[model samples]
Target: MSASGAKTNLHEFVVQENEQVAEGLWRMRCNTALAAELAPGQFVQVSVPADASHILRIPLSFARADARSGELDIVYAVVGEGTRRLSAMAVGQASTMVGPCGNGWWLPQDQGRALLVAGGVGLPPIFACASMLAQTGVGFDVVVGAQTASRHCVGYVDELRSMGIHEGCDCARKVVLTTDDGTLGMRGFVTQAMENLLAEHTYAQVYACGPNPMMAGVAKLSMSKDIACEVSLERMMGCGFGACSCCNVALVDGTQALCCTDGPVFDARRVQWQTR
Candidate 1:
């Protein structure tokens, strides 16, 4: 077992489909046994084939994993040369991935309603987090944000709505969409929408993933409410394991934790939020 308490393995995968789901965002579905081992909030390090010069594997979090079908869905943004190369990978192309890395989201301890927040490409893991909550029959509300209408992952929003129709929940589930440019949905940051939701609902826990400043805002709100919160952090990792210290997350306790081995998910209160 690795430091995250999950078994890590190197597996070969074949691309089943790779297509653009939104502006600068691509969704890739691959067939691999690693799908069976992946859990919500965990990430994988994928080796982009035919790029010997760019040796570092592209670390990606999955949107969905189906063990029965042996398929994994990853949604990523084209931010750099690595992701650009990954988007160009053709159907049926094969590559190697090291996965089941890091810890995953934990269920709410108090068993009341939960709140989920995602910004930009962070929707992938938040989608996974919603799936976990749905499977466990935990009621939840979601707030998703993007730069503009074209950048939003509408499919994930639809999926979240469907998950809300569970037999176990009585109250209506809220799924709020926000965009900074006001191209679609609510015209503001996710924090604005979350503020309204927090006012209307009593929550047991909060889970978030996004840019540093955005997540810092979320952490502040959750802490102010005295609600337990977990956040999936993004970092530039050199080695997906613990061999390198590239992905260090500063904590409130004045200690640094490795994002690869110690987290990608952590308690929101433990993180030392940096303001812009």
Candidate 2:
């Protein structure tokens, strides 16, 4: 891995495994030398080679990366033809990827309590952050929400629970699962779950990745509670690099930034949703 903050180049990865983890969600693991440098919240743009009509690559956040093993995994929902093509790929398939794009979640120096909020496909980067936090002594909690338990829940929750048990840490015990149908967890949104957590304990910061409304709700809640919060922004990209101006987002400061290069992550308080 390069030194911290060093730029990474595009690299072709060999698909090692691809499988459906949920109803429409698939997790793909690739072997790449770039995996050694990818951080939580950083993403890769994958080319949909199987579909000739789709010229643009789809952006996906890192679900897990092992520097030692040179392996990186991405979990995504097959929502379109582009992703459907990715889902149908076989092991040993080759995919061209340009990544560790944008910024990742910033970890606090002190080992204070942290809160992570994720919904649907947004769970990938949050899951990666959880793995990083688990290695530290930082106390943390995760609020995972989806439309339904059977179809929407990301399958890594069990693995996280097992990790907590093996490590003997309480981090995994605090995972709060919520669903609209209440099939497996609280019958409400993840923001409601955050409300419950905030009522019980104080956190150093909150990190969120999800739908716009969901993330905006988390941001509102964090602002009301005076807790620092950062959100990962999702936008369309003609080019994963800053050359394309397709992913511009307005900031509270009356300027615009590119989600591709400037950030897929931004301070929730500074983002001007009105301008979007």
What overall lDDT goes with each candidate model?
A: 0.92, 0.84
Cα-based lDDT at residue 42, candidate 1: 92
Using all chains and alpha carbons, the TM-scores for the candidates as numbered come to: 0.97, 0.93
Per-residue CA lDDT of model 1 for 129-153, tens digit only, reads: 9999888878899999999999988
lDDT tens digits by residue: candidate 2, 1-276: 222364757788999999988878889989998788787888888886765878888988988899999999899898988988998888998878877788888886656788999988888888888887777656688899988887564458876555435554455458889998889789999999999999999888898999988998999999999888889999888888888799998898899999988788888988887524
What lDDT does model 2 reach? 0.84
TM-score of 2: 0.93
Clashes of 1: 0
What's the C-alpha lDDT at position 224 in model 1? 95
**lDDT of residue 232 for candidate 1:** 97
Could you tell me the lDDT of residue 241 within candidate 1? 90
